[model samples]
Target: MEFVERRSGISLWRQIADQIRIAISNGEFDESGALPGELALARRFEVNRHTVRSAIASLAREGVLRVEQGRGTFIARHTKLQYPIGRRTRFSAGLAGQIKSRGGFLKSHVTEAATGHVSRALELEPGAPVLRLERVSSADGVPVSRGISWFDAERFPDFANRYESRKSITAVLNSYDIEDYVRISTRISAHHADPATLDDLKLSPGAITLRTEAVNAEVAGRRLEYSHTFFAADRIELDIDHQAGTALP
Candidate 1:
């Protein structure tokens, strides 16, 4: 309330916007919850309707709010569910543990010799056999992520075929005697989606996404799998936990 700054160097609209952002970050507005009405905010800030509108527009463009016609402006609330970066977990398994509601569909499977990135990740020759599985996961029917996973074909010749009907990649790995594997390293970054990614994830062209790249190895530290997953920033939040003594070996 009373967000306007008459003598500050910052513009009135910008000051209003900054305060609203601070409120959102501080949990003033619940995650994924509705925001105050424009007239209500205008009254509280002692500003004209146009001033409040401008502040809302700035926040919307910055991915802080989503304006739904007829419904109202809502806080872009997303909870970043952390997937353990130090332990090997299947996509469904990890997500199930983090998010109470989850769903997914396997998209495709490709079997070929590992090349370039895959080979380098697995520490094998460029032509080493590998199986790739593509999947799209969702929460409450909203697309959350697109994933591609690669496994050593020599170690799991049936990986591609068996995984087609399986929901848990860890189960498939277990069938191949890879009873346990741990995450070696996880890299995270933010980027906009390409045309293909946009189509697969059903995201707007300008939407932001979080990319996670992870490598997994047996207990002995022999790398066996690598995966890349892209998450829709608007729909889902990612959480990461790094407890002491659980770090990658």
Candidate 2:
């Protein structure tokens, strides 16, 4: 049996849809890969048949399930893209062979004094100047991840402007004569999508997100960037490279 929260700030049908999506991803269905009938699903979810139908319809629209008029609903061939996270975690390089087209665009940018978290992550003094950049990354024309990054404003005062033209963080850093940096650490968590994340990632209500908090540093271990990235759970999965070499550039 499956459980759906009644007062979790999410609609019942949407919650059911989310659960069904997750089940499909996990291959919970039988060998035929077809979902159970509406009545069975309703019973499992403790909802009405109409609500179950609504959930199925939503999944069908999202290309997660195929519904034939006479045939039952079956899982679609929408495999999640695997994204590698390693010491040298370049966005474009991470998804190179997995996706034909990849892009990152700045949504917003601001320069402000670093807060405690940002200051500590970047090893800057309290209230040190920093550039905050909001960006969205797309794979095959579909938005897959949203990221917020902070860089030392004193070192990269023109970072936002450079990124607007470069469109690649690596390229922008190169222009500043900082040729190489590596991921120092990454912390990951899962959560329900917020309104802003839903809008940015084009995800439905109650969608799950994989959030990664990362810090990048130069060859000498000087912090260069701090970022928080949210990835659509259905669209991509993180592949952690535990054997990634940390050789300095």
Tens digit of per-residue lDDT, candidate 1, span 1-249: 455778876567777876775676567865557889999988888888898888888668656688999999998665656554436455666667656677787888878888898898899899988888888888666677899989888878778667766667777778778789887777788876777678887754445678888888888999978989898765555566565124432
- The predictions' CA RMSDs to the true structure, in order, are 7.0, 2.8
Clash pairs (backbone) in predicted model 1: 32-77, 80-237, 80-238, 80-239, 81-237, 81-239, 82-239
* Separate clash counts for every candidate: 7, 0
Best by TM-score: 2
lDDT of 2 by residue, 32-151 (tens): 888899988888889999998888887776567889888888987777889888899888888888889997679999999999999999999989999999999999999999999999
Off by over 4 Å in 1: 1-72, 76-82, 97-101, 244-249
Per-candidate TM-score against the hidden true structure: 0.68, 0.91
Best by lDDT: 2
User: Whole-model Cα lDDT per candidate?
Assistant: 0.75, 0.88
Give the runs in model 2 whose Cα sits over 4 Å from its true position: 7-10, 245-249
